[model samples]
Target: MNLAEEIQKRRTFGIISHPDAGKTTLTEKLLLFGGAIKTAGAVKSNKIDRHATSDFMEIEKQRGISVATSVMGFNYKDVKINLLDTPGHQDFAEDTYRTLTAVDSVVMVIDCVKGVEIQTEKLMEVCRMRNTPVMVFINKLDREGQDPYDLLDEIEEKLNIQVHPMSWPIGMGKSFQGVYSLYEKKLLLFQASKQKLDDTDTISIENVNDPILNDLLGQSSAAKLREDVELVDGVYSDLDLNAYKNGEVAPVFFGSAVNNFGVRELLDCFINIAPPPLDRETELRQINPTENKFSGFVFKIHANMDPKHRNRIAFVRVCAGIFQRGQNYHHVRLDKNFRFSNATAFMAQSKEIIDEAFPGDIVGLYDTGNLKIGDTLSEGEKGMYKGIPSFSPEIFREVINMDAMKTKQLEKGLMQLMDEGVAQLFTYEMGSRKVVGTVGALQFEVIQHRLKHEYNATCRFAPINLYKACWISSENKKKMDEFVDSKYRHIAQDKDGKRVFMAETKAWLQMVQDNFPEINYHFTSEF
Candidate 1:
C-alpha cells in the first residue's frame, strides 16, 4: 500500500476505566476479535495461573492490578488497530495521562453497578482537554447491576456529554440473554462457554419481537426491550459522527466482557467510526499524518521488561509519516541524529521486529538510558511536540540504600527509574541524599519494590514533611540566585538542573509566592 493508503488503514485508541470495571477483560475480548490471542486469560484467576495480556509485570500478576501502560497492535477486518491499555487505578493517573497523548480516541469502560467514579471523571477531564472522542462500554451485564437506562442517564449527567445508545441489553443480571442492536436492527443471543474464555456465538434475528428472541429471553424482557427501543428511537439522540469526533457526544455500548457478548459488534462499529491519524501540534505547526517524512514523539519509557537483560524501551508514537527500520532520525531533544536498528512493535510484553510502521503506530526503540519523556524524533525537521505536561507529586519521601556499600547500585537504579518517568527525583545541595516525589502514595511502594526486585538494590523509604513541589524560574538572574540561597524554604534541583522548592504547608507555598511575585512558582511543568 502507498503511504496515504497505509496511514488511512490504521486506527489508534486507548482503554481507560476505574479500577475493577472490567477494562482488562474488555481489552482481552477485543484482542480475541482481532485474532491476537486464541484464548483470553482472566485478570485474576485461581484455577488458571494465566493473567491478562496487558498486566505483564510480576507485581501486577501478584496484585491483580495494572500499574503501567501497555501498547498492543493487531489487524482486525483489514484495519490496523493500535490499542493502548492504561492503568485503571488512580495511583497511575500520571502514566495514563501520558498515554492519552498518543491516541486519537478512547474507549472508557464503566461498570454497570458503579456509574462514574473518581478516576473515570479525572480521565474523562483529560480527554475533554484534548478534545479526544470517547466510546463508552457498559460492562458486567451478566451480574446484577444498575438499570441500563439509569446508567446511560448517569453517564450523560456525570460526564457532561450527550449519550447515544448504539446497543442496548435485553435483560441484565442472571436473566441476561443478549443485546439488541439499534443500528442493525438485530438481536444477538449468546451461550456461556465452559472453557477458559467465552467462545464466539452467532445467532441473529431480524426483528426484536421475534418469537425466538422471546424464547431466548423471557416474554416480559422481549416486550420491555421492544418498548425501550421505541422510546430510544423517539427520544434519545441519534448517532452523530461529527459530534462524536468533536468529543461532544459519546456512542454507548452495553456488553458482558466475560461472556464475550456484544464485543464484536462494538469492535466493528469502533473501527468504522473511530477517527484515523490526525494532526499533532508541535512548536512549529500542526503536523499532518499524510506528510511524507517520518516524525514522532516519545511519550513513555519503560525499564526492565526483562529483568535479566535490564532492557530499556522508549515508546514512540508515530505522528507524521512512515518509519522504516535502520533509518536515521533527528533526536530533537538531544540535538543528534541516530538510527534504530531494532525497532520493534509490542503485543503487551512480547514484541517482534518490524520492517516499517505508519502514523498512529507506536514502535518501541531500544534505549541505553538516554531517552526522556516527551522527546521528539523526526526525519524531516527539528521541532518539538507540545502539551505533554508533568504533574506535581502529592507525596514526598527520602530514599536510603539499605547497604551503604551498594550506593552506586542504588544511584544507578534511581537514575534508571527516573528516566522511566516513574516519578520525580530531586536532590538537595548539602548532601548526596535524594528524595522521590509521586502523585500518589502507591508509587513509593512501586519504587521500593522495583529497586529490590529488579535492581537487587534494597532501599528504605522515609516520609518527608512536605506538602507541595514547585518549579521556579525567573528572568532576573540575581533574584533567581538569591531565591536559591534563601534558607526560608527547602530547595532542590530536578534532573534537568531546574530549581524547585518544597514547601511544608499551604501557608509556606503561599508565602513563597507572595514574597517572590516576579518569579514563576509553577505547580506543574510543561515540556
Candidate 2:
C-alpha cells in the first residue's frame, strides 16, 4: 500500500490516567464497542479472561492496578487502532514513558472529581515534551462527586492546553446520562439495559438509516463537530484536508467507559479524526550500524506461549525500510548481531506470520536472542534508536543470604528479572560474598516469592538504610583536585575548605534517574 493509504488504515494511540481513574474500564469498553471482544469484562474479576487483554501480569491482578504496559489492537471502520494501555501508579510511570515512545498520540483519561493529580501532571509533561497530540477523556461521570466543567478548567489551567470539548456529559454522578458530542453537536444516548448481541440486538442497517442518524452523519448539521472541524481548519487553513485526506484534528470524546455509554460514537470519532501513521511527521533516527541502511526499533516485547518456542518476542516499529525474517540485525546495546528467524504481526496476543514489515507498522519477532530494551536492529551500519528510559523501583529492601546450594538458582532468577526490565540487579562482592540491591522494601518480597515459586529457593530479607554520598562546595581547589585524580574515592574540599565525602548521598538520586532520564546525565562530573 502507498504511504498515505497505509496512514489512513491505522491509528496508534495510548490510554493514560491517574490510578483508579477508569482507564482499564475505558479500554474494555473500547474493545467491546469496537467489536474486538463480544463481552465487556471487568478488571476486578477476570470474567472472560479475554477482556483482560491489557492487564496480563499476575501482580496487576492481585493488586488491582496495572503494573506494566499492555498492548491491544482492534478495528473500527476498517481502520486498525493499536492501543497501549499504560500504568497509572507513580511507581510504574516508567512503563508509561516507554510505551509513549512508540505511539503518535494519547487519549488522556482523567477522573472528573480528582481532576489532575501528580501522575497526570507527570504524564502531561512527557506528552508535551514529545509534541504528541492529546485528547482528554474526563471519565467517571457516573460516579458521585464529580464536576465536568471544573475538571475541564483544571486541565486547561494546569496543562496549559486548549480545552476544546468534543463531547460533554449530559449529567453528573448518579444522574449521569450519555454524552453530547460538542464537535458533532449531537447527543449520544446509550441503551439503559445491557446489550447482548443476539437476534434482538441486531438491527437492519437500512431501517436504522433515519433522518436523525443522517443529521449525525453530516458535518454541517453537527454543530459541535462542525465547530471543531472549523477550529482545526482555521489553525491549519493553508493545509487542505483533501490533499492529506488522512490528516485530522485532535478530538475529545466523553463517555462512561465503564457502562459502555457513548462508546461506539467515541470509536467512530477516533477512526474519523485520528491521524494515520503515514500522515504523522516521520521520526528520523538511526536504525543500524550502517548510516544508510534500514533498521527498526522494537517497541514491545512478549514471551511466546508454546513450550517449544516460549522465547522472547520483540515488537518492532519499522522506522525506515522493510525488514525480512531470518536476517541478521545488529543489536545496538548487546553490541552483537542476532537473526530474527520468524517475524510476524501481533493481534493482541495472537501472532500472524509475515515475511516482511514496512514503516509505520508494528511487528513481532521471536527468539531475538539476547535482544534488549533500546536495542536497534539494522542490516548494515550501526545506528542507535533512543533507548526507552529505565524505570526506577519506587520501593526497596535487602535480600538475605540464601543457602549455597540455591545461590546459582538465585543468580539465574536475577538474570531473568534483569531480562524482563522490571527491576535492576546490583551485585556487590566482598571476598567472594555477594549482596543484591533492589528498588524498595516491597521488591524484596516479590524477589522472595519468585524464588520460592520459580526456583524453590526460600530466602529472608531485611530493611537496610538506603545510603548515598553528598558533596558541599567548600572551594578547596587542592583537595578537590587530589580527589579527582585518585582511584579510591577521596574527600573533595571546595573553596570554603570543607570536606565533601560519600556521606551526603541518598537513594533519591537513583529514583530521579529512573523517572527522569531526560535530565539525568546532562551535566558533566564537575557540575
Candidate 3:
C-alpha cells in the first residue's frame, strides 16, 4: 500500500487504567479478536499456568502487576493495530505518560465496582491536557457492581469528560443477561467462559422493543434495557466522530473482560471510529503521517528486555513515511546518520524482525546503550519532536552499594535504568554520592529487582533528606555559577549532566527563589 493508504489502515493507541481494573484482560481479549494469541493468559490467576502477555518481565509475573509498557502489533479486519499496554500503578506514571505521546488515541479501562480510582483520574487529566482522543471501557460486569447509570455519572463527574454510552449492559451480576450494542443495533447475550471467547448469540434489533429480546432475556431485563436506552438517547446527543476526535467527548462501552463479554463490541466500534495516525508536533512543524519521508521519535528506552543477552530496545513510534530496514536515518539529538539492520515489531516480549514498517506502527531498534528517552529521528531533518519531558521526582533515596565487588555493575545498572525513564539518577558533585528519585516508593523496588536479576548488581536505598530535585539554569552565567558555588552541598548533576538543586525543604526552595530572582528553577525538564 502507498504511504497514505498504509497510514489510513493503521491504528495506534495505549490501554490505561487503575491497577486490577482489568486493563490487561481487556488487552488480551482485544488480541484474541485480532487473532494475536491462541488462548488468553490469566492475569491474576495461576490456574492457567500462564501470565499476562504484557507482563513479560519476571518481576511483573511474580507481582501480578505491570511495571513497564509492552507493545504488541497484529492485523484484524485488514487494519494494522498497534496496542501499547501501560502500567496502571501510579509508580509507573512517568513511563505511562511518555507512552501517551506515541499513541494517537487512548482506551481507558475502569472497574465497574470502583468506577474511577486515583490513578485513573490522574491519567484522564493527562489525556485532557493533551486533548487526546479517548474511549472508555467499563470492565468486569459479571460481578455485582454499581448501577450502570450511577457509574456513568461518576465517570462524567470525576473524569471531567462528557461520555456517550455506545453500549449498555442489560443486567449486571448474577442476573446479567448481556449487552445491547447501540452502535450496531444488536443484542449480544452474555455467557460465562473462563477459557476463550466464543461467538455469542447476537440478534440485530432495529427496534429496542423487539419481542425477540423478551424471548431471549426475561421480560424485566429486556424492559430495563429499553428504558435505559431511551434515557441515554434523551440525555446525550448522538455520538459525533468529530467531537470524539477532538477529545471533547468519549464513547463508553460496558463489558466483563474476563468472560469476554461485550469486548467485541468495544473493539468493533474502536476500529471503525478511532482516529488513525495523525500529525505529530516537532520543534520545526507538525509532521503529517502522509509525508513521504520517514520521521519518528523515541519515547521509551527499556533495558534488559532479554536478561541473558542484556538487550536494550528503543521503542520508536513511526510518525511519517515508511521506515525501511538498513536505511540511514538522521538521529536528531546526536546529529548523526546511521542505518539499522534489525528493526523488530513486538508481540509483548517476543519480536520478529521486519523489513519495513509504516506510520502508526512502533518498531523496536536494538541499542547498545546510546539511545535516551525523547530522542528524535528523521529521514534527513535535524529538527526534534517536542512535548516529551521528564517530571520532577517526588521521592528521593541514596543508593548504597551492597556488593563492593560489583560497584561498577551497580553504577552501570543505575545509569541504564535511569535512561529507561523509570526514575531520575543524580550524583553529588563533591562526594559522587548517587541518589535516585521516583514518583512512588514502588519504583524503587522495581529498580532494585531489575538491578539484581538483570544487571547482577545489588544495592539498598537509604532515605535522603530532600524534598525535590529541580534543574536550575539562568541567562546570567555569573549568577548561576555563584548560586551553584554557594549551595555546593545541594548541587548535583542529573544523568545527562544537567545541574540540579537538591532542595532540603519547600520553604528553603522558596527562600532561594526569592533571593535569586534571576536564577530559574524548572520542576520539569522541559525548559
Candidate 4:
C-alpha cells in the first residue's frame, strides 16, 4: 500500500488501568479478536496455562503484575492495530508514562467494583496533557460491582470527562445476562466458551421486548435492560465525534474481559471511531502524518529481550513518511547517519522482519550502544522532538557487588538496565561507589532480582538514607566547578556523566540551593 493509504489503515493505542482492573485480560482478548493469538492466556493463572502474552518478562509473570510496556501489532478487518500494554502498578509509572508518548489514543480500563483509582487518575492527567482521545471499558461485569450509574458519576467527577455509554448492561454480577447496544440498536446475549475464544456466537435481537430476549435474560433482567436502555437513550442520545477526538468525552463499553463478553463489540467500535494517528508536535513545527519525509523518535529502549542473544532494541514510533529496511536515517542527537538492517516489529517477545512500515507503526531497531530514548531519526528534515520526561526517584540505594570478581558483569548489567530507563544510576566521589534511584522501592527489588537472574550477578542493597537527588548545573561554569569541587564528597555523577548531588534531608537540598543561587537543581533528567 502507498504511504498515505497505509497510514490511514493504522490504529495505534495503549491500554491503561489500575492494578487488578483486568487491563491485561482486555488486551489479550483484543489480540485474540485480531487473530494475533489463538487462545488468550490468563494472567496469574496456575502453571497449567501460559502467562498473558503481554507480560513477557519473567519478573512480571512471577509477580502477577506488569512492570514494563509490551508492544504488539496485528491486522484485523483491514486495519493495522498497534497495542501497547503498559504496567498498571503505580511503581512502574515511569514505563507507562514513556509508552504514552508513542500512541495516538488510549483504552482506559476500570474495574466495575473499584471505579476510578489513583493510577487511573494520574494516567488520565497525562492523556489530557497530550489531548489524547480515550475509550473507557468498565470490565468485570460478570462479578458483583458498583452500580453502573455510580461508576459513570465517579469517572465524570474524578476524570472531568463526560462519558457516553455505547453499551448498557442487562444485569451485573451473577445476575449478568448480556448488553443492549446503544449505537447498533440491538440486544446482544453473551455465553462465554473461552477455549474457543476466537469464535464468537453472536445472538442479536432487534426488539428488546421480544420473547426470545425475555427467555434469554429472564423477565426481570429483560425489564432492567429496557429501563437502562431508556435511561441511556434519553441522557446520552448523541455521541459527539469532535468531543471524543478533542478528549472532551469518552465512549464507554461494559464487559467481562475474562469471559470474552462484550469485547468484540468494543473492538469494532474502537477501530471504527477511534481517531487515526494524529500529527506530532516538534520544536520546529507540527509534523503531519502524511508528510513524505521519514521521521520518528525513540520512546523506549529494552535490553535482553532475547536471553541468548542479549540484544538491545530501541522502540521508535514513526511520526511521518515511510520507513524502509536498509535505509539510512539521520540520528539527530548524534548528528550522524546510520543504517540498520535488523529493523523488526514486536509481537510480545517475538519479532518479525518487515520491509517497510508507515507513520503510526513502531519498529524495533538493533542498538549496540548508540541509541537513547527520545533520539530522532529522519531522512529529510532533521530535528529532535520533545523528549520523554523522567520522574524523580523516591528511594535511593547503594549497590554492593557480592562477587568483586564480577565487577564487569555488575557494571554491564547496571548500565544496560539504566539505559532501559528502568532506574537512575549515580555515583558518589567520582565513581568510587555506585547508587541506584527509583520512583518506588519495589524497583530496587526488581533491579537486584534481574541482576541475579539475568546477569548471574548477585548483589546486596544498602539504604542510602537520601531524600532527594538533584542534577546541578549553572551558567557560571567557574562558580559551579568551585561549588561541586568543595563538596566533592557529597557530589555524584549520573549515568550520562552529569553532575548530581544526593541530599540527606529537605534542609540539605534547600541549603545547597541557597548556597549556589545561580545553580539550577533539576529533579528529573529531561529526555
Candidate 5:
C-alpha cells in the first residue's frame, strides 16, 4: 500500500486503567480477537501457570502486575493496530504518561465494581491534557458490580469526561445476559457456545422491543435490557464520533473481559470509529502523518527484553512518512545519523522484523546505549518531538553497592534502568554517591528487584534525608557557577548530566529560590 493508504489503515492506542481492573486481561482479549494469539495464553492472576503475553518481564510475571509497558501490533479486518498495554500501577506513571504520547487514542478499562479508581483518574488526566480520544470498557460484568448508571456518573465526575454508552449491559453479575451494541444497532447475547474473544452471538435488532431478546434473555433480563436501552436513548445522545475523536466525549462499553464476553462488540465498533494514525506535534511545527519525510520519537526504552541477550530496545512511534530498515535517520539528541539493522514490530510474544512501518506504528529499534527517552529521529530534521519529560522525583535514596566485584554490572543496570525513565539516577558531586529518585515509593522496590535479578548486582538503599530533587539552570554562567560551587556537596548531576539541587527540606528549597533569583528551579527536566 502507498503511504497515505497505509497510514489511513492503522489504529494505534494504549489500554490504561488502575491495576487489576482487568486492563491487561482486556488487552489479551483484544490480541486474541485480532488473531495475534490463539486461545489466550494466561492471565494477570499469579496462580496461572503461564502469564499474559503483555506482562513479559520476570518480575511482572511473578508479582502479577505490569511494571513496564508492552507494545503489541496486529492486523484486524485489514486495519493495522498498535496496542500498548501500559503498567497500571501509579509507580509506573512516567512510563504510562510517555506511552500516551506515543498513541493517537486510548482504551480505558474500568472495573464495573470499582468504577473510576485513583490511577484511572490520573491516566485520564494525561489523556485529557493531550486531548487523546478515549473509549471506556467497564469490565468484570460477570461479577456483581456497581450500577452501570452510577459507574458512568462516577467516571464522568471523577475522570472529568463526558461519556455516551455505545453498549448497554443486559443485566448485572449472574443476571448478566450480554450487551446490546448501540453502534451496530445489534443485540449481542453472551451465549456459552460463543464465549471466545473472536466470536459472539448477535442478532440484528432494529428495535429494542424485539421478542427474540425476551426468549434469549428471559422475561426479567429482557425487560431490564429494554428499560436500560430506553433510558440510554432518552438520556444520552448518540456516540458523536467527531466529539470522541476530539477527546471531548468517550464511547463506553460494558463487558466481562475474563469471560471473553462483550469484547467483540468493543472491537468491531473500535475498528469502525476509533481514529487512525493522527498528526503529531514536534518542536518546530505540526507534522502530518502523510508527510513524505519520516519522523518519529523514542517514548520508551526497555532493557533485557530477551533474557538470552542484553539487548535494549527503544520504542519509537512513527509520526510521519515511512521508516525503512537499513535507512539512516537523524538522531536529534545525539546529532548523528543512525541506522537499524534489526528493528522489530511486536505481536504479543512474537517480534517481527518488519521491512518498513508507516505513521502511527510503534517500531522497536534495537540499541546499544545510544537512544534515550524523548529522543527524536527524523529525515535529518533538527527540531524534536516535544512534551516528553522526566518528572522531579518524590523519594530519594542513596544506592550503595554491596557486591564490589559486580560494580560493573550494577553500574550497567542502573544506567540502563535510568534510561528506561521509570526513575532518575543522580550522582552526588562531593562524594560521587549514587542516588535513585522515583515519583512513587514502589519504584524503589522495582529497581531493587530488577537490579538483583536482571543485572545480577546486589545493592542496598540508604534513606537520604531530602525534600525534593530540583533541576537547576541559569543563563548567567557566573551566577550558576557560584551557586554550584557554594552548594557542591548538595549538588548532583542527573542521568543526562544536568545539575540538580538536592534540597534537604522545603525551607531549604524556598531559601535557595529566594537567594538565587537568577537561577531557575524546575520540577521537570524538559525545560
Candidate 6:
C-alpha cells in the first residue's frame, strides 16, 4: 500500500479518558484491527512485552499506568490512522495537553459506570479550548455497571457536548454480545481470537441479528433513533444518518477487549466514520519560525532503546510546507541550527525511512541533541511560538539524599527523568542537597519504586504544599504604602548610595502609582 497516500487520507486522534476507563484497551484493539499489531496486549498482563511501543517506560509497565504519551499508527480501508494514547491519570495531565496540541480530534473514552470524573472533565476542557471535534466511547458497558442510557444521560448533562451514539452495546458487562452501529445500522458480532503485536489472527467482524438488536430496531426504538438522528443531522450535516434507512446514527460494535471481543467492528467504525486529518480543520497558531515561512512543533522526544543507536529522537508535527531530511532546521530557542540526517515515519516503535513530511504529518528526526518539550523547528528567521503550556506539578515531595552516595548520579538521573515527560524535579540546597520530585500524588509510590529499581538511589519524601502566593495590587501594595508613616519612609541608602524603597506589597503599589502615575500596576502569582 502507498503509505503516504494512506497518510494523506489519515485521521489523527488521541485516545483519552479517566484512568482505567478502558482507554488503553480501546487503543490496543484499534491497533490490532488496523494491523499495526496482531494480538492486543492486556494492560494487566503486560503480555506482548512490546517495550516502549506505546507506554514504553519501565515505570508504566511496573505500575500498570501510562505515564507518557504513546504514538502509534495503523491503516484501515487504505486510510491511515495515527493515534496518541495519553496518560489518563490527573497527575500526568500535562502529557495529555502536549498530545492534544498536535492532534486533529479526540476520542473521549468514559467508563460506563464511573461516567464523568475529574480527568475526564479536564480533558474535555482542553478539547473544547482547542475546538477539536470529539467522539465519545462509553466503554466497559459489558461489565456490571450502570445502564448505558443513564450513562449517556450523565455524559450529556455533564460534558455539555452532544451525545450521539454511533454504536449501542447489545449487552452490558460480561454479557456484552456486540454493538449496533447507528450510522451503518449494522449489527456486528465478534469471535474469539488472540495474536501478538506482529501477528494478525485475532477478531473478525460479521453481520448478525439478535432479538435484542431487533427489538431496538422496532417502532418505538426506531422513533427515538429518528429523533436523535434528526437532532444530529439538523446540527451537523456531516452526520447525515438519514442516509441509513434504518434511521440509525451508526453501528456500535461491542466485545470485551480483554477477551478480544468486538474488536473488528470498532475498527470498521474508524475506517467508515472517523474523519481524516485532511478533512479536519487546520489549526492556526503563532509559529516561532515566522508565519510567512514553514515551522513545526516537537510533540515528543525519546531515546532509542537500541544501545548501538543510543541517539535522541524528536517527534515533530509539520504545521506547514515540507520538511526534508538531511537539511538544517533552525532551533529557535537554542539560537542554533542542526541538520537532520535521517528522518522516518513511525508506527509505534517501528520506523520507515521517509525523505520528507508535510503539514499534518508526524515524523521522527534523528540525532537532535538537547531537544526538549515544546521546541519549534523552522526554516528562516527564528522566533518563538506561543510556547506550549507548561505543566504545573500539583504535589511536591522532597527527595532526601540517603548515604550521600552517588548524589551526583542522583542529580544526573533526575535531569534525564525530566526529558522523559514524567515528572518535574526541583533541588534545594540544605546541609545536604535535597531533591524534590513533583507529580500527581497518586504517582508517589510508583516514583519511589522506580527510584529504588532504576536509579538504585535510596531516598525519603518530605510532605510539602508547593503553595503559590498572589495578591491584589490595590488592596495589598497600595494600601500598605498609604498607611505607612512618612517618618518610616525616610530615604534608605544602599551601599551604592542609591535610594531603595524597602516597602511591603501594599506600599510598593502605592509608591509606584503615586510616583509614576502613567504606569499601570499588575498583580502576579509567586510560586
| Top candidate (lDDT) | 3
Per-candidate count of clashing residue pairs (backbone under 3 Å): 0, 34, 0, 0, 0, 27
The model with the greatest TM-score is: 3
Native-referenced Cα lDDT, model 1:
0.87
lDDT of each: 0.87, 0.59, 0.91, 0.88, 0.88, 0.60
Candidates in order, TM-scores: namely: 0.97, 0.74, 0.99, 0.96, 0.97, 0.73
Per-model root-mean-square deviation over C-alphas: 1.6, 8.1, 1.1, 1.7, 1.5, 8.3
Error of 3 at 221 (Å): 1.1
Model 1 — which ten-residue stretch has the worst lDDT? Answer: 193-202
Cα error, residue 198 of model 1, in Å, equals: 8.8
Q: Better model by lDDT, 2 or 3?
A: 3
Which pairs of residues collide in candidate 1? none
What is the lDDT for 280 in model 2?
A: 19
TM-score-wise, the better of 1 and 3 is 3
- How would you encode candidate 5's per-residue C-alpha lDDT over 354-439 as one tens digit per residue? 89999999999999999999999999889999999988888889999998999999999999999999799999989899999987
Per-residue accuracy of model 6 over 349-423 as CA lDDT, tens digit each: 567888876566788877545677677777865644443544434465667767477777556555555565556
Q: How far is candidate 3 from the true structure (C-alpha RMSD, Å)?
A: 1.1
| lDDT score of residue 484 within candidate 3 | 88
Better of 4 and 6 by lDDT: 4
What lDDT does model 3 reach? Answer: 0.91
What local lDDT does model 3 show for residue 79?
91
Higher-lDDT candidate among 1 and 2?
1
| Candidate 3 per-residue C-alpha lDDT over 1-527 given as tens digits, one digit per residue, 9 for 90 to 100 | 67888888999999999999999999998998899998988897775469988888888888999999999999999999999999999999999999999999999999998889999999998998789999999998898999988998898899888899999898888888789998899888756875666674777888998888788888888888889999998998889899999998999999899988888899889999999999988988989889889999999999888877878899999999999999999998888888888899999989999999999999999988767899998989877999899999999999999999999999999989999999999999979999999999999999999999988899999999999899999999999989988999999999999999999999999999999898999999989
Over 417-525, each residue of candidate 1 has an lDDT whose tens digit, in order, gives 8877789998876574588988788888888898888887889889889888788788899888888787434888787776778788999788878898777888887
- Across 327-362, the per-residue lDDT of candidate 2 in tens digits comes to 788776567778777777754556678786555567
Give the worst 10-residue stretch by lDDT in candidate 2.
Answer: 518-527
